[model samples]
Target: MILDSDTTKVISILGNDYTIKAPEGQEQALMDAVTMLKSALSETKRSYPTLIGDRLLVLAALNLCSKQVELQRQHAEELSRYEEQVSATVEVIEKTIAQG
Candidate 1:
C-alpha cells in the first residue's frame, strides 16, 4: 500500500513545517503524535530557554525516546508475567486431565 505525497499532511514543529504521510486509516494517529511532539518540545524549551534549534530538538527527542523505552520495558515485563500465569494454568489443566 503506497500513499502519494499529495496525501501527506503538513505539521509545524518549533516554527518549522514538516510533511508526513501515514497509512490510509491512521491520519489522526499521526496528527496526535505530532501534537505530542510539539508539546514536548514546547515544554523542553520553557525549561531551558537558552537552548535553540538542533540542541532543543535533540533533547526533546532523547526525552521522548527514553520514555518510550521505559514503557516498552514495562510492557515486556507485564507480558512475561502474563505468559507465566497462562503456562501455569495450562499445566494444572493437563495434570487434572491425566488424573481423570
Candidate 2:
C-alpha cells in the first residue's frame, strides 16, 4: 500500500506496512536501514518481525545505551547541584547548632 502525498517510503515488516517520510533521496537509505534491521530480526525463522526477537533486543540495547549516556550526564549535573545545596544547608545548620 502506498500513500499518495507522503514523502516517506513504505516499508513492510512483520506483515505491517509502515510509511516513513524521509528527506529527499533518503528513501534508499531508509530502506537499507530497514533491511539491516529486518535481517537482524529474521533469525527466528519467521517472515514477520518479532518485537521480542534477538534483532529487536540488539536495537533496543543500542538505543538504551545511548539514552543511558545522556541520562548519566544529566544525573551528574543534578548531583552537583544537590551537593552544593546540602553543603550550604549544613554550614548554616552547624553555625546555629554551635550558637545554641
Candidate 3:
C-alpha cells in the first residue's frame, strides 16, 4: 500500500503504541527501522534489567548510533578507494590514447 506524507501509522514498541508519520512508499522502511530499534532495546533490556524508561531508550539509541557511525565511516573509506581506482583507470586510459 502507498502512504502519503501525512499518513500516520500506529506501531507497537516496548508494549506501547506510537503514531508515526512517514512519506509515501516508505512505510516498510520506517517499520523496518522501528523493528531494528525494538531489537536493540530488547537486547539492552536483557543485559541491563535495572535500566528503565528513558535510560533504556537512550542506551539503545546510543548503541544504534555508534553502529551507524562506524558503518558510515567504513562506507566513506570504501567510496574513497573506489574513487581512487576510477581516477587511476581514467589516467591509464588517457595514457594509452596518447600513446596510440
Highest TM-score against the true fold, candidate = 3
Q: Which has the higher lDDT value, candidate number 1 or candidate number 3?
A: 3
Residue 72's lDDT within candidate 3 is 100
lDDT of 1 by residue, 1-85 (tens): 9746335788888778988777778888998898888888998999999999989999999999999999999999999999999
Candidate No. with top lDDT? 3
**What TM-score would every model get versus the actual structure?**
0.88, 0.39, 0.89
Stretches of candidate 1 above 4 Å error? 1-6
Model 3, 10-57: lDDT tens digits are: 988767899988787888899899999999999999999999988999
Model 2, range 3-31, lDDT digits (tens) per residue?
Answer: 55536678887677888897777777888
Flag regions of model 2 displaced more than 4 Å.
1-6, 44-100
How far does residue 69 in candidate 2 sit from its true spot (Å)?
Answer: 11
**Worst window of 10 by summed lDDT in candidate 3:** 2-11
Better of 1 and 2 by TM-score: 1
Q: What's the distance in Å from true for residue 70, model 3?
A: 0.2
How much is the lDDT of residue 28 in candidate 3?
Answer: 88
